[model samples]
Target: MKKLTTLFLGTLLFMNNLFAQDQGKRFYKLPIYGKYFETSQQFHRVDTLKYNTMPASVKKLYTNSAGLFVTFKSNSSELYAKWCVTDKKVGLNLTAIANKGLDVYIKNRAGRWQYAGSKGTVKTCEDGLILEHLDSTEKEFLVYLPLYDETTSLEIGVEEGASFVELPNPFKRNIVVYGSSIVHGASASRPGMAYPALLSRRTGFNFLNFGVSGNARMEKEVVHMLGDINPDVFILDCVPNSSPEQVSERTVYLVSYLREKHPNTPIIMIPSVIRELSYFHQNWNNRNHLQNANWKTEYNKLIAKGGKALYYLDTSSLLGEDHEATTDGTHPSDLGFMRMVEQIEPFVLDVMKKHNIH
Candidate 1:
């Protein structure tokens, strides 16, 4: 009877330990969407207001035969992903979908390439698609895949199309970035290779990208959404979306609103990258300059108002003196993106140190 009691006690303790371990494990349902496609009305529509202003290159890129790619980052040695894709009437098949894989390049660490062990074409199942990683760990990893066909919608998650398993919460000291098309990653060559993605990789932090192409006007709705997320740092990089007056008006209000809920949260304001020419040809050169000035004014105001947590990062020096970092005088090329990362690293590190989040 004594031996049986001892055995039962040992088993109970082991089960309790298992439950604790599982609870400490974290999972993230990262999102990946399919390529963009336009309907007939969108393709052939002629608007008198914007006629002849559209770039030929932009039109070409949006036409048939183009696709959008998505990337995922993970640290789990064993990974399982489930995704749901919508087949929007267009009858083309997915060309090929596989992990873009990762080149484990690290600072002061030897680089190695890790490939997805699974092979063959993956089809969207009724319950969604699943991909598994052979090994799981605490180190960071990147997953890249291309989306083809007329698919317009996709939902990705872990086992239940929602379960990510046994990984650290990189967002413990969250960094939320808000901006325009550049921040949304217009043309970064690969999905996960964008600057924000790279920054997440370097700093090992969770990133929430609130970049909407040509849509970041410091709108009230956007500010409200930003306030929903509790981030340690909030980065505003929306100079490309507003005129000087609009920027000034919204900056003060947005900052004030955020301060109301998160009195101690640090906010970082960034100006536009030095790029010539404009998408709308609306005198952006002067607008960008004034936006910077207004941002400084608001930043100083926050400082004076006993908000010592406010910070400003001048990104002017990021792309070099000649603005060589941009691809088409607007968006960043691969090289330009890397340089941007280099500039932001110091500021990020400072924030990390203050918060003691590695």
Candidate 2:
């Protein structure tokens, strides 16, 4: 009994020491994304919201740190981040699922992006955070920003005596995507697992995710702002937010606006993913079909109008007929997200190949 008690005390002390070490070590930190963070960090967002004298509405949307990446080379064995989110309350996804989370990816010697580790906070990043700890060898790393939540403050921290420098943007062309909540990362397990994030990784290309939850209606304000982008391919996946009437009304204008602005840029249109409610409820089927029909009509019209760089993707098989791809019947689960990438990446790569944007 005495020996056991001693051993217990020793184990407890060791555990405490580990926590103390984690708490005591200070990190050499860097902020590497966002417009507000540009002078201090490498900024990735230049959407419609960045212009001078921009409207208050646009400012509210562009303020978040979504779709930003922190590129760096570090030799630290420990990785940490200090972040405070604007929204701490958990929504459809859990707090850890949506808000206080960080994912770290490292490039292997074979030039493949591999998942190194992930961190979750029960509290908020206002209290700071400690993410993955790696070997003390120098390596290239990219940290993806949170998808659903807005960040107020962010800093990447590494161990002392580690060599660190900002990584230059590697790709020449941008993978521009626009859509609704799913594009904004509804139920993704982490910020890094969002469909756009996955697509960027698989292709090793740059991307800008313009998915705003419930607000990506085919508004002229949004589309007109989008016209300024000169992307390799502009992906449209916002039909789920629009009604059939809106689809018929706005689809032509949206395509024409983009085509007028980027005459040679390939535009890819993605209709709504298959909904589980359609298989169970007739109303859902009718509503979804109507919207798709309207969108199809507009796409065909654009083709007839001599859309030289247009590409329309029929996503009927995106989530598959089995209908097990979503967290609810609406948003996709991680499994569904993987399935989505597998299907979508091939088509995107094909478009990229055709345009020589690879």
Candidate 3:
């Protein structure tokens, strides 16, 4: 009787395990290779030749592609993703899916970027997480990767037998943005939510995000490297990192160096976005005014010389006067980032149209 009881228990355990495996068999998954698809990642993990040449400071900053994206086409009705992020802590105020997370945007028949679904970061020790499925008929899709986290590996899966094609990296001559933490996607809800990323999704132009956190001071080395990539437009949004003296001293050289290299390409100079701290702190307010004053002085000098390629954006109203745009006194919240996008959208569109890049 004891032997019979043991045999019955073993049989029940086997049946339960078998049932679980059978249930998992319903979804067919295939790995999407990084080599086949186009990625906005400027540096590959394994590409040491380029990595070795960089200054240690640059290598650390350039390794993260905050606003980069992937473009692909497939006949599969279902789209899925499995990604591994190196960071254990995925997000802060933004959810995991928006920070170290990835999201999907589809170009509708109307040619507008519309939200699909996202794969939120997983807490398990496993290297991968199965993402939410995007239900659709045959369509092309854009996958926006993480903003703040380092991606170790990523693969997109689809229906077992549908056709798949890798779209070319849309940017030949990219709109290269060099700036402060905002360009690095600091506190953005997701990678795609960054202003440069938004411009890409909305306008169908390719952008290379060169945001380097607080280190985006007018480093000449940074400008020299930026000159190598032929840019249709150069967005210099680095004012937050500079003081009025620094802006006054370095702004001309930085603009002139790029202007000389890419004479035809448009360059947009943005004064610092209004910091929330300025409202309460007199020192901060005075600094903001000084920087803008220095910037406007520079702009007027260029305009006097008929410098049509150079442009200026007065960012005093970026988040609007409601005074509810930031998470910290300096860094913008997701809402703040979105509002920033709203103001720049038309300006960029008009610039591209004028240059025939659109």
Clashing pairs in 3: 98-190
- Candidate 1 structure, TM-score to reference: 0.59
Please write out the lDDT profile of model 3 over residues 1-358, one tens digit for every residue: 9999989999998998756534322233332222211334532311224435544655466655466567677766666665666655754555676666777777688867777776676542222323335455667777777766566556666666766777765544477778787877776766677777776766667666777766777766666666666767888888887888988888888888888888898988887888888989999999988888898898788778778778888666788788898877777877887888888777876787889985
Candidate 1 C-alpha lDDT tens digits along 1-358: 9999999999999999856544434345433322211234231112212323333422222221122223344444444333333333322211133112112221222432233332213344222224445333333333433211222232333322222433233333567777775665544444344565566656666554555545567777557656766777888888776777888788877888887878888788877775655434567766667777888887888788887567788655556665556656677766776877788878877976785756
Better of 2 and 3 by lDDT: 2
lDDT order of candidates, top first: 2, 3, 1
Number of residue pairs clashing in candidate 2, backbone atoms closer than 3 angstroms, sequence gap of 3 or more or interchain: 1
lDDT of 2 by residue, 91-136 (tens): 6544474445677788898887787766666555544444444777
Give the best candidate by lDDT: 2
Q: What value of lDDT does candidate 2 attain over all alpha carbons?
A: 0.72
- What TM-score does prediction 3 earn? 0.80
Report, for every candidate in turn, its global Cα lDDT versus the true structure.
0.52, 0.72, 0.69
Pick the TM-score winner: 2
Cα error, candidate 3, residue 352 (Å): 2.8
